[model samples]
Target: MGGGADDADCGDAENKLGCILSYNSHVELCVVNYTMLAVSLVAAGGLLEAERRLDPSRFGRKFVWQAAAFMAVAAFQITLCFVVNCSGVSIIWNAVVAFNSITVPGDTPRHFLFMYLLAFAMALSLDVYYAFTLELLTTIAHLCSLLLGGLGGFMYLRAFPNYGRQLRRPLLGAWNGDGGGGADDDEDDGSTNSSTGSV
Candidate 1:
């Protein structure tokens, strides 16, 4: 009797597993995943919109620029996975880090962004390992946001020259000229020309 009961329990477990595998059940998990994914995507979109309205000069400040790139990386990965069923999130994340290392040196915001990406990627790996539907989907979405945000930030930075420095150059030249009596020469020449014409 005990053996028969054990066999029945095993059979029930197998049936439940089959139902989950078929995707006809576990509606709650699916709903949660879908909801989180939608929210993540929408949030990224909002950031992109706000980024467009901001002045390009702001990106040169370091933190804001790198943060934008980070967001872009997250967005790209998530969108790729969601739309194209990508499974290479790790590869893309590493590539971003590598790009940063190669292109930007010193203790910069990109390093900080690297740390952040590393942490998020680890969390995503754990979610996948445990077969967590909502958690996995959320991680993917977050990744996409980071990816896309970084790209948007980079684009914004590229849209303008170093406006702050460019603006300063002319001002600095004018100040130097004034200090050297360059303005006085112009006035003196003008006065001499007027006197000659009058005579």
Candidate 2:
């Protein structure tokens, strides 16, 4: 009986350790992912401003420096993932594919709505930056930064719920009944049962 209890205790300890490790891994991955995203966005913004102004100096020397910094951070993130032997390539490739696949089919209403909202936000940000800075060139640079930041934020929010759901559902299931039990109960009851049974 004592041996059995010891074995059970060991098993519990192992499980808890695994859970803690998994949680830490997820937190690390999220930080790396966002850091890379920010780096890419900043680099892209710098390039956009350089092109728009057609003058490297107008965007300022610091813009180029910032672009390099962002890329270095992104590289660090990639290296860390590779070192950890995590499935980083799959995540990166899937994200690229999904981004590329987002398109409007025959100019649908939703497509127009998305376009309008995006354009309005871009214009608004530009206007605000210009109004406050009173420098047309610097305003353009800032506007690009705002757009990139907004895109990163949007992607983070979209991915977060799915990630959180995956992480929590298993533990939640063990504590409560299976998470899908309510749905299963509803199905078992039959959606059409009330009207059809009596008739």
Candidate 3:
């Protein structure tokens, strides 16, 4: 009977340890994700600014500037990730500690959700800007890029399936390829040609 009690105590201790370890791991991942998201946001902003300053007629030059901005952002994000790794702290812990401690008054989850939605909104806005400036081929490429990022975000949000549902609708339109305006315009021209048969 004494041995049974000892075994039960040991089991409880083991479970507690496992829980602590899991929580720590979760925290570290949160930190890394948050950092990456933050860096990406900065990069998106730079790209937007560059896009805004670009001459509309200078498509080639504009693409070059945009690409340069993207490279710069990618470099910064990579460097930040490397620095976090070198600091001997788990990136997950960075996320866990920051988010838990940084809550607004009244409702933590709601505030965090709003923050995420705002990030999504910014990304979507960038996508719209890209769509407007890029040629059809480039626009499709950029859309694909956004889609992949959205997929990754969705997977992350999936861990909190209930909360993830709230984010589902706003992100849906982000993946939609450029509107069919170009196609419609082309169709109109083709029909006109067929009707006239000379021009």
Candidate 4:
């Protein structure tokens, strides 16, 4: 097994190291994309259910509309990911297909759809961010990463204004088993009533 041809076939260890790194990166990126898709779908479904159960006095028409919009955007991203995966083209060509698929739209503005695309694109760049050094390009690229992530986060929070409250209330209730948040809610209600009465 040890000969000139075997030595050439095995090649240098450094070359093998690069291949190993590239293979691991692609595997990790696929894992991240699948995770993003799963979480997006869960968030979209939860928001839709919350909208359905919302009280008009607490959540007005505007609130409902925003919830719907957020849900739609999440669903749209999930759909695009599936489309790209099913197309079986290389990443570059799949991106072209995704662009055409999203832009030929109906009601929603093209620019807003681009924001959804930007969020996914930023997610995909996570691997590149890890691989690159801290230079000007990397700095600018990471800034774009944060901006897109923030935009998507803000939209989700806007759609679910009481999300934190609701999420924490359950944990609080479970921990104390007496609904610990009720007193704080009562105080808030009392303050609101008094302020409204004065008005």
TM-score computed on alpha carbons, candidate 4: 0.32
- TM-scores for candidates 1 onward, in order: 0.26, 0.22, 0.27, 0.32
- lDDT against the true structure, each candidate: 0.38, 0.34, 0.35, 0.37
Residue pairs that clash (backbone atoms under 3 angstroms), model 4: none
Instruction: Choose the strongest candidate by lDDT.
Output: 1
Cα RMSD, each candidate: 17.4, 25.2, 21.0, 15.1
lDDT of 4: 0.37
lDDT of 4 by residue, 1-199 (tens): 0011122222333444332223223444345444544443443333334433432355565445545544554444334324322211122212222322222112212333344445446444543554353234333433443444445545555655654333333322333443223445645756886989942
lDDT head-to-head 1 vs 3, winner:
1
Clashing residue pair totals per candidate (backbone < 3 A)? 28, 0, 8, 0
How many clashing residue pairs, candidate 3?
8
Task: Please write out the lDDT profile of model 2 over residues 53-79, one tens digit for every residue.
Answer: 332333454345434544543354345
lDDT per residue for candidate 1 within 1-199, as digits (tens), equals 0011112122234343333222224444335334433433333333333223232335345445555665665555445434433322332343343333222211112323344334445434534543443335445544454454455435544654432222222323433433223334445755886989842
Model 4, residue 85: displacement in angstroms? 18
Considering every candidate listed, which one attains the maximal TM-score? 4
Worst 10 residues of 2 by lDDT: 1-10
Instruction: Please list the residue runs of candidate 2 whose C-alpha ends up more than 4 Å from where it truly belongs after superposition.
Output: 1-43, 46-60, 89-199
